[model samples]
Target: MNGIIIGQFIPGDGFFYKVDPRSKIAGIFFLMIAVFLLKDIYQVLGALLLTFGLLIIGKISFIKVLKGLKPIFILLIFTFVFQILINRQGNILVDTNLNISLINIGLVIILFVIWRFLAKFKKFNFLLFLGFLFGSIFIFIYSSFSFDYNLTSFNLQIYEKGIEMSIFVVIRLLIIITLSTILTLTTKPTDLTQGLESLLSPLKKIGFNSEDFALIISISLRYIPTIFDEANKIMQAQASRGADFSEGKLKEKLKQVISLLIPMFIIAFMRSEELADAMESRNFVPGKARTRIHELNYSYRDVLVTAFTVVFFAVALLFRLNVLGY
Candidate 1:
């Protein structure tokens, strides 16, 4: 809501956007240190709280924010399920598969995800809908198994501490993933290039060319999203052709995926060729000087932000060393 569109750049004086890309970069680094350095549960919880605060201050809706977070939910659940039973350190709490461990972890993830997107709850109604969808699928599978007259059931036992730690780790990953996305969403690729160049400018004397490297890195950053969109389109077309992806057995499904992938690769190759021609037509040459239209002008705000990021990182490091945050 910082008056800047979520994925599109709007030229505005949002304090975060205006505080110099280099300082913003430093802030990200500081946040990483702060989040990872603290072993204290309270500290970790506080960090997430602070992250949400920053999210709000940036005027990004928690709904849109968690919409970004939702893509990684499968990974979160996978972590939960695996850690629930796989971790053998702590004492087992229950014998049933759907015991306290599973319930606790499932609830934690469900709650964290919900709270993480409270601003525009309606937008995340799809998640609730998807939850119902998966629940229905699971029921269908269970009924199918029961109709086969299989009386036995599989039960997984999990430890309590593992559940606790798993929740923490997954939540931490969420924060990191969300923040990383936020960085790219809020900052322009050109701004990011300058940030990287500035950060690595010190290495220029060591034969590291930041400008050229930054150019390629930004191009690569641009390439991933482009490739993803293209792949999605290809898949949609294949789906329309009745290319079944979900109904087959594992190997059969894999073959279906491969069939889809071959076209994707072919298209990617075509795209690369076209990109090469475009670059050639534009007289693209690496290791060359070019004037930038949007120049970086650091104000006092940028200086203060930089100093604060450095100081915050130092303090966080000291906390890790047990000199602070006790």
Candidate 2:
């Protein structure tokens, strides 16, 4: 939870920081579309490179971007592995007999021990986990060491296309994640609220309350870290009371989760109630006209960014349609 960076903002004086929030928001949307339109490996790689450049322009380090991705590292790996396992479009690359035996189990245990030993190095934890995952997988795939008694046996097949698709999917995910991280890192919550409100204002003709909707989004993003912190505190309190959430059976884990959720829901209600009271105390009203200290205005920089993003997205669309021919 602490690793999450989607809603968090960091103070910086960079190109993106100076750009209008509306422009940044719209640019990000366009770039996201561009990323999704990417079909070829080179095109995606090019997009990744552009994202890196944007990171530099935003004055955000690659390490910080990687940190933002730490929380979803496992999800990416699972996605990659799933794609590899389910894809059967190409010839088999690795076809081997995997066996479950005493030696194999011990080796896997040792690998886990090593991973735990290296857990203190927080910076490269994701890479370590990746290594552990692939290491265990390879151990099972090879099964080089085994006892006379075998517990189970199965054949593992890895297709060429699966590897290709997995890489593609993981890269696309990385690009999207990094792009979003860039946006949140550079854009302030209030600015994002205003930007979204402005962009969504057209919905007012349809009886939609853009202000309320924008406020909701802003509040949700603002509270993500708070809620995560609350969850951590709850987890720690539970741990102090002999609740082992990490090391537990499915039933025990579920019980622990319920215990955590009950308190979380209570806290959420309390927070909402407190927020409502505070707003009422300040004469806050929903669906009311409001004035801002800083009015949003588009400048030449915003125009340039919009144009560049539109062009980038257009090229990506063309590429996706095979009109560009790579």
Top candidate on TM-score is 2
Off by over 4 Å in 2: 1-6, 118-131, 145-147, 215-288
What lDDT does the true structure give each of the candidates? 0.70, 0.87
For candidate 2, the 10 contiguous residues with the lowest summed lDDT are: 141-150
Worst 10 residues of 1 by lDDT: 140-149
Using all chains and alpha carbons, the TM-scores for the candidates as numbered come to 0.62, 0.78
- Please write out the lDDT profile of model 2 over residues 8-108, one tens digit for every residue: 68888888888899899888888988898888667888888888888877678898888899799889979988998899887889888888777888889
lDDT of 1 by residue, 1-326 (tens): 12323354545445567667777787787778677876755666767886787777677656766667778888988887676657777677755532223334454466556655663677676676566546543443333322244434466566777787777878788778767766766788778788889799789899999988887777776677777777778778888988787797999899889988898899888988998899979988776777877777889977866675576567667878887754
RMSD to truth, every model = 8.7, 4.9
Model 1 clashes, total count? 1
State candidate 2's TM-score: 0.78
| Model 1 clashing residue pairs (backbone) | 1-59
